[model samples]
Target chain A: MTAARTEDDLKTLMLLSLDGDEGAYRRLLHAARPLLVAYYGRRMSGAAQADVEDLVQDTLLSLHARRHTYDRTRPFTAWFFSIARYKLIDHHRGRGGRKAAETQLHDKIEDDFSAESLTARLDLDRLLDALPPAQREMIRQVRLEGRSVAETASSRGQSESAVKVSIHRGLKALAARIRGEA
Target chain B: MRKTDDIIESLVGDLKPVARHALSRRFLVAILSSLAVSLVLMLTLAGLRVDMAVALTLPVFWIKAAYNFLIAAIALFALYRIARPDGDTGPVFREIAVVVALMGVAAVFQLALSPEAVYRRLILGHSALHCPFLIFAFALPVLVAAFLWMRAAAPADLRQAGFMAGLAAGAAGAFVYSWFCTENGMPFVLIWYSLGILATGLLGLLLGPRLLRW
Candidate 1:
């Protein structure tokens, strides 16, 4: 597909996903993976395949977590590539790479990727599984199950504020896990 | 590692419509509420200038208030943009530079038009020693509020975001304190007030990587 057509397609999928269309969201992620893989592969030519795949997965996770920050009025590709570039720079910085080279590379990757084909694998269930049962349960209900805090609070015999705090702390802990701090 | 497909499945399993403009709303609410707190704090601790009616009638008082308010407004705009994952802060930085340069020009003009005898007094008002520190102190609540809300957002450059947060809080603090500050010199506001805002921004820079890791 042409770049303009691809941008339109992804933008439509993203809008649909934001409107809570599961099918559209899945397609969006699926569509994003290959572009991410190709993008990372080009930058990290000397890195292991697993490392590149990990970066791709990390980028995807960040995209999922930060999807709400995407402004509908902006180009979808710009938003996607910004997150991708951030993760790339973050990956290098975490590994003690040269700052000047990283910045030069950053400028080089300013353009968005064209549609391409590739495959990769990764997971988050392990991190979730490591959380305390109560925290895990709270996160699952409010975050994954789409339940209101009040409903979860009532069902769990806890105050609404307590449920809110639990979810907040739980998410914080989950974030710590993602950062490898826990 | 688990399958990427499985991860995608889990993510899509229970998707919900995120509230539109939620990020900006949270940021606005955070800054404004904390500003209100700082105002209350200043009122309780120092009270307004003794000659409030007289101060209100003077153009110098409004100039001081406007100087601080303008910085707060621009810095807040920068903070808002930097809080987003894809938000660019380049334009905001240029805008802030423009505001500061304008203030610098105003200070120079104010000095040139006045007699040289009072230059020192104009620059170093009675509250010179405490003004910047007090501005920093009043900014704490707003800084904390900005940081707390910012943790929920994805800022690409943590230090830059933190600096903007501090800059915003500091200018806001100065603006709130302007009501109680009796100093009517443009040089005093430009120098001491800017120092306070710079100190807060430095503090934010130091704390960004640690407190804003998420």
Candidate 2:
């Protein structure tokens, strides 16, 4: 079956929007709305649908503001998730630190296309093996499984901040390694 | 970490297309450019075939123009529909090159014979550039090649979801040029336009691998 809406499609639309096509921007907003609703609803507990709706509106606004940072020709979900994930973190950080064991995190960045997709195309399983376990795990849990930092932290018994920090550092390290800069 | 490209690209699908661009503008440009070229050539022919020059204002002149534009538009539209902007272009170019190289040979033969002498000859004209030989033997095929290569390499990336945009543009350009053109109805438009289009297809086939290689 055709896979879910991928990111490249979104990138194309965003680029078109940048080129003065309001139509593309409209498409981008439409596609990202559902994602925002599901994202906020899943993470916020005891929160009403209105809360999620508010978050969706907020996320779309933020996306519109920062859409320039996004690159065309990449996956929309990954970028969208990255934005959503950041919005989620901002939400948590805004609410003061999480409770001792209840701290959760999620990342919406789509790092999968550049790495896993390329790996599959190149069939470089051996190269993937070269990554340190923690770094690789971060990549897998966030990029592959579509988990947020909060979810990963909750599952792994790590602090939410720690999870976010690790993911940030891990991706940096992975980039260095991939580019032979390590 | 893995799918940076995918994650980054995902934002666009979130977008909804709000408008559609018609092929007419680009088509008009094609017509204008081609006609400009044809007019210059037609004027040149006036020195030789004054009768033909007088006939240019006749409705038959428009028939030829319309015919060429239609032929180019259809071929381009088909190509746009079938082309996958995201799909691999390497193999596509390999196929295209073979076709173009063969046509290049035919274009050489076409250059040797006089279209006027064979089809509409009562006089002769010459040019260092932009002649029938130059356009058919050179410009036509070259433009075709460029059009195909551009699509295979880098499409307009406009919001429009069609692949044949370049071909259509080329047809518009070529059709206008055809308005000024005369071939030995020996090489009907089928032969000429097809050859021109195939040459572009071939160009894409030959160069897309390198031009669009990631």
Candidate 3:
């Protein structure tokens, strides 16, 4: 309870989550991720410990799915652990597991620009499209290209603040375009 | 297997972004399961009642139909909340309400019809949603199951765990609720039944840490 901020506060968070505030639910799930990671790590080979993180994410999913089953009157930790424990049982009980696939680290993005996407307009390529070629290059180099603004300024033989201003304007213009577009 | 510390940290941080999406889907599943139970009750229990003599009686038939319709209507109304990606049930009351409505339908139907007949038509005969209630129930589950199946198939890591864990957890939760659950009548459903289903969530949580492992 020492690291708990306040025991009563944590309890209230539990109560709020069980009561169904989406934001609180998200916080509750995230807060428990570390615990699940540690718990799953204990059951795994050291080299495979990273898989514990996967277990944490999976627990979030199941908790999300089964959240409705939680009674507000109960302790959040107790309710939270109940699902986690069951998931652990199933993980062990499961047999004939497949070997991990060697896949690219980068996630695949669906090319479809459906209206359903929340950040569909935020696609970097699309955002850059609205900027002039030099402005885009300046911004990309200093930002996505990961050069510091000073380095970018020096490379372009411009002052750092001027480079900053150029990049800032470029981003602003892009934002305006997209905001208007949206 | 690079085992580089930097790469591990990078990937770990990158994957954090996807967790919210995973949770949202799981929330959908949790809501769907309870809804499925209610749908089944609503469908099969049409023209349903607790007292057979009263159930089949014309006046009672309409009452049962209205009850079934109201349950379905509530589910439909709640279904709208579900359709809004960001909106979802806030507490266990919804879970219990759905269950109680479903169970109420069953109780009333049981009263009107013997368990033998109900089982004969549903289990023994293998009737696939022959009645309206059954049709509606089956429809909702089938649609939900399909969406979930497709979703799991396409995801980076299939959460076969979500469903498998959900069902097992659901049953376990029901078991726990049987302890705290007081079977009074409709009010029990309106209040206590939700408590029971929320209790089912306890099983989910107990197992979540292990079950969610990729």
Per-model DockQ:
0.39, 0.04, 0.03
For each candidate in the order shown, give its overall lDDT on alpha carbons: 0.81, 0.47, 0.44
Writing each residue's lDDT as its tens digit, candidate 2 over A58-139 gives 6666665444434344455555665565555555545655331124441332233333463242223333345777666766
lDDT of 3 at A41: 60
Ten residues in a row with the worst lDDT in model 3 chain B? Answer: B175-184
Q: Model 1's CAPRI class?
A: acceptable
Interface RMSD of each: 1.7, 12.4, 10.9
List runs of model 1 lying over 4 Å from the truth. Answer: A1-5, A97-182
Q: What DockQ was computed for model 3?
A: 0.03
Best-to-worst ranking by TM-score: 1, 2, 3
Which candidate, 1 or 2, would have the higher lDDT against the true structure? Answer: 1
Count backbone clashes in candidate 3: 40
A1-182, model 1: which lDDT tens digit per residue?
Answer: 32212666788999998889998888898888877885687677574566877887888887788888888987777678777777777776677555753674457655433222111111233456678888788887788669999998999999999989988988898788778854
lDDT of 2 by residue, B68-142 (tens): 456454645444433322222234334434544554454445555655454333122232124333334323432
Residues A1-182, model 3: lDDT tens digits: 12222224445655565554545444454446655664466455687676666566666666555544444444455455545544544454453232222111112112221222312322464568568887888987878658898888888889988888888999888778878988
- Return the top candidate by TM-score: 1
Say which docking band candidate 3 falls in: incorrect
Comparison by DockQ, 2 against 3, better one: 2
